[model samples]
Target: MSRRLLPVAVLVALVAALTASSSPAAPRQRPRAPSGLAFYRPPARLLAGRHGSVIWSRPARGTLRLAGAKRALVVLYRSRSLTGTPIAVSGTVWVPKGRPPKRGWPIISWAHGTTGVGDPCAPSRDSPTSLAHGYIDYVYPELSAWLKAGYAVIQTDYQGLGTAGPHPYLIGVSEGRGVDDIVRAARELVPALGRRFAIAGHSQGGQASLFAASIARGWVPELKLVGDASYAPASHIADQIKLVGAFTAPSPISALGAEVLYGAAAGSPAVSISALMAPPALALMPQLEVKCEPQLIQPDSFGGLAPNRLLASGANLGPLLALTGRQNPAVSIPVPILLAQGGADATVPKPFTDQLAGELRAKHDRLDYRVYPGITHGQIPAAAQPVFMRWVAQRFGRR
Candidate 1:
């Protein structure tokens, strides 16, 4: 390493870590290696080919009084990695009273959407501006409702968020692996949350739920999934990127996300980011991507990533659009698959979700898809929880 450039690289790495730590688009964190103890390690493929099976654990339990319910957050987790490197994975299992509930509990895998680096970005800071305006976003309201219904809520932090290692972005296998590990952990924790779990999530989480349901059929012989309910999942990342990427308007947030994706891709051997793009685009990434607060993000920052980069990545829409089969079909499910979308969502296009559901119906079993006429991305789950809760009850055959 060049002595003159060493300080600058260190500064950049520090700034990147701090910048990522914050963000209206905040993320979670893990224990960093000791200060001044630096050794470069490349990204490894941790969760692959039946990934979660290799990293299952006994459960971790904690108690917290929340929303008038004496709920215990049982974490179904594992700290081992499929990559041969140690990685931590965990989920918050909110078990209602009666220490696992007498009649046992139906599993509700509470999936969360994208938050950039897969880490819990910022806590409840004084959102005075938005709070004053009476706005509440991403609180996982289902936790309260599911608890009241005597269902155990298993919310996964996924692999990268809070757990150690570089987040494998949009990689269903890894996320799904994390989901499977947690579910297995949950079943052992209470012993009542056995098989036949109902999966639910929004955006990125929705996608993960699909992957989990698909894998439960094979990898997790013990787990029986009855339904998969996804809300505006990024079923088509390539297309969604194209849809959002159309906002020719310049936005730093967009650039940063693209930058991260590129970095992850650059960092990912499954899909090469550098091989997909030419020099200037690849070279301009560092300069174009970074932002201090990430207050506003749009489509433009993702320019060099789209049209070609996404297509070349081999996961482009072409295959996802025409997907069908048992492992992880692109469409709905063989069992009950409920897909709800907010028509006004600016992020994951509702039309794309509709198309995905339509494709799934051709070879899928039971499926229900609803599009809230005027709702936006954030409002979809809030509006449909009543119906979702009932659907979940039905899936578990809850009388």
Candidate 2:
């Protein structure tokens, strides 16, 4: 039997056909933004907070009941981007009921995973039936579990998302600063909020948490960050780029390649979209920025990209690669770490996370790496909940 290498364009067209037929809204020209996110607009400059300071805060509409917490509100806070430019960020904070332990409730600064670079993709904008509601917002169960266990949860929307500007997706410094600054904003908003805290994240957030642990002492020295926990954290960016490039069609893997390219190009002025992607792929780059992850996953949204076509062959990826490597959780974490990885995770493959764990250990970073067999990337956080709760309890000196 003769075998033929599948043409990338054909594969993409097939994917598009499948997706278009399945999705009722596929016929629509422009995808609609997720519900409850259309009206996101922060004031021009509503009094700045020092770094993590809350510029202004208000009750988050329609989030209190869904979170199952005593109180929940959206806070528009101040955070600098990767380039150290002043920008407004938004996040949701849930305050649990009942009495505090005199020291106040310990905080769980939560960093979310990839939700697209679009402004409407912010986790705080999640609503009942929206895409974010399914992806990031559904974490209510996890957040509710923590609330029941008496830990306040603060979820950052990160810079550029939910407010204005180009979201610096996966830029460690930008993301980590957003995570750290939100905690600072939380403290300022909730007077009863405790200084003692832990950072927990899934996927991209996992990487952000690692970065947070490294920089917390210097960035926000006032907050007492005990430890960090990463669930299926992202690592090995150089290898990841290769993995994305290896895909031959318009699959989710290739979509990620396009997304990262867009992010890298957006973050650094040195890089240009046209320089990295071919004309066809470059034409679609603008869509990658405006659509949510779910929309992007729809095959029609991403025209199949040729292998190695999106990433320029001769372009020196050194600066971008260096930035990525720098964003990896350095072994310099001052506190202990709890990492949970899914053995069967395809998105963030087990080998990469295992290797990351080994690297952390080699640097003498305190790590409690736990692996759950048969679990996938999205399932790791919830699957490892029991372990996470126990580990977090111990970190807070609770039984």
lDDT of each: 0.55, 0.76
Instruction: Point out where model 2 deviates above 4 Å.
Output: 1-40, 303-307
TM-score of 1: 0.67
How far does residue 107 in candidate 1 sit from its true spot (Å)? 1.2
Best by TM-score: 2
By how many angstroms RMSD does model 1 differ from the true structure? 15.9
User: Highest lDDT: which candidate?
Assistant: 2
Clashing pairs in 2: none
lDDT score of residue 56 within candidate 2: 55
Candidate 1, 1-399: lDDT as tens digits? 989999999999999876543211211231232221111121234322222222222223222233424445423244334354445565566666656544456677767666544233211111334221121234445567777777777767666554455555556666676676666656555555545577887776787788877766665655667888888876665444445435444444354345335424523454455554445345545433222113223343343333333223333433222221111327435568888999898767677887778777876557798889888977888888888878888888875
Where's the lowest-lDDT run of ten residues in candidate 2?
Answer: 22-31
